[model samples]
Target: MANTWNTDNAGVSALASGDFDGDGHDDLALGECREIADENIDDPCGPEEFAKGGGIHVHYGNATPGSFGYRQQTLNQDTVGVAGVAETGDRFGAALAVADIDNDGRDDLIAGAPGEAIGTRAGAGAATLLFGGPTGLVDAWGEGHSVGYQQDTPRVPGVAEAADAFGAAVATGDYNHDGKADVAIGSPGENAGSGGVWLLPRASVNGSSAFTPAKLGLPSPSSALAYGRYLSSQ
Candidate 1:
């Protein structure tokens, strides 16, 4: 709870809740999509930090209603075991989703950085996966923990294009009627601004290899639709 408020332009732009510690009480994840970094453990938002690098803060819950535990941790690309680098406009926590992606009973976290650059393509977008463990969120899963996915990634479909904004929104569900959860990433700027959604099944995610994805309900180019701008799951 220390240093929770600062002048770092750390906007709480996104949020998710789950039993990340397996402690029965649901924990909260707050996304500061416009955060800049000082990396000062005592004060991340101190004067030294100023830019839109983005980050997420986890607040473990207490047994008492509307209460959080003493433990709090903030995550960003700079954190050990996390993927990518904390850069201006990465916006790492612009969108977030929680699910038992590995089907290991513990719910995992998926964070979207819609403004991330891919290769030389600015704003090509990306998403990061973090596993949930007994202690809390960890990037320790052998196969796919703390992995970053973009259009040109091995298992992910499509080509990396500028201003695609692929991770503008995110959601999870059993899209293929499988027992494990699948991920859907939104690219609101894809295909000349028509927008697109990519569906990655559990098997594809587990394999960490190239696989074809179902492009959910796409509208024609002339329709001028941003089809994947927002998403939610039951």
Candidate 2:
């Protein structure tokens, strides 16, 4: 038998599956990258409320097909485990990636908000890590041992800049030959559209101190290359 899950939004922009709760049953992550506007008001929102970000919904799997049960939880910038507040144009769920980023047995979640604005940098973009725990995905800064990180946090590197689109894309692998997994984030709007990528080592994500990220950029003399527009790892 087949089953269907639906959201209020018309377009379900992205999808990812994994054992997010470590129950051995596969779970699904759905990204709704567009905001649903209230039609009642002609100008429903102000500048900061327009396109007020999107959301990531997690549906835990069941032993029986077509009976996966209701959505376990909904995730967004304002979610307790998430690192930031939902903002206009953040598009928080534009991209999604899953891995055991903290080297824990349970898989964690990475969400990309390419339109996220940092400070005064509108559309600078951001990404967040929602660590898994005994009770399933928990807050990064909440109590009871949930590992978490955000692009704007000191624990990670780099700040959001205007039009950086920092979380345009994301991928994971053991880039340093370490047993733990690492993350690579794409910023296609950097350097006057030349673009760039930031490598966040597993150590850095799991560490407490601030660190600089290892950045990749197009070679000199190349303008508007947008090198890190997309990324992948072996």
Candidate 3:
């Protein structure tokens, strides 16, 4: 019988793919950004009390060719090794990007939780970086193997403000011609509707530092442009 999973209003909100296991066949990552859940482990997917409490499902590819029918895993803030806590409106998997940030031959996953609160700033938005390894996605790093990015993070531009939506969209590339990958994050709801994009270097992905797009000489957009409503990179 074919494997099946179900949830109401927990539709696939985002997607990305990579050979997470280095098995040559590409794997799949699906985001159910509208998923609802609570702290009740007894009834993990219930009550609808935590709307927009998103999650992701990963399916490693099989040898069948052109299929991703291998083992499956579900992840969310509440997952034992994942970072953060599941809260109403956090929308953890609303956006996703894939890249070999560390150039370790394994592609990493970048997730956006546009409704996350930064400190006391509700809806300030945030991004989570999950690394991949020979054994598939692994959280071997001390900080749950997951690193978070937000407006208020040290060296990251801007302050954490309500509705900033920093993780509303995401994309990745080697912007500086560096062998490692860089990331671009969108805050379409920033600056009272004047959206902005932030570019984080590969070093940042490895727990080093951050850099805004402007520092790379990208011109800023006009007021209210909502520049990062959608973003892309090679």
Q: Report lDDT (CA) for all predictions.
A: 0.70, 0.62, 0.70
* lDDT string, candidate 1, 173-193, tens digits: 777776667878888887777
Say which prediction, candidate 1 or candidate 2, comes out ahead on TM-score. Answer: 1
Tell me model 2's lDDT, rounded to 2 decimals. 0.62
The 10-residue segment with the lowest total lDDT in model 3: 1-10
lDDT of 3 by residue, 1-234 (tens): 011122234456677888766767678877644433444333322224323377766778988978774565566787656677887788887888888777777777888888898778888998888877776774433123567888777878778899888888887877777666788888987877677788888738333333334444556654566657676657
Best by lDDT: 3
TM-score leader = 1
Q: Give the Å error, residue 198, model 1.
A: 0.8
Tell me how many residue pairs clash in candidate 1. 2
Model 2, position 26, has a per-residue lDDT of 72
Count: clashes, candidate 3? 0
Listed in order, each prediction's TM-score against the native is: 0.80, 0.74, 0.78
Model 1 vs. true fold: TM: 0.80
Please say which candidate is ahead in lDDT: 1 or 2.
1
Clashing pairs in 3: none
Pick out the ten consecutive residues of candidate 2 with the lowest summed lDDT.
Answer: 42-51
Q: Candidates sorted by lDDT, descending order?
A: 3, 1, 2
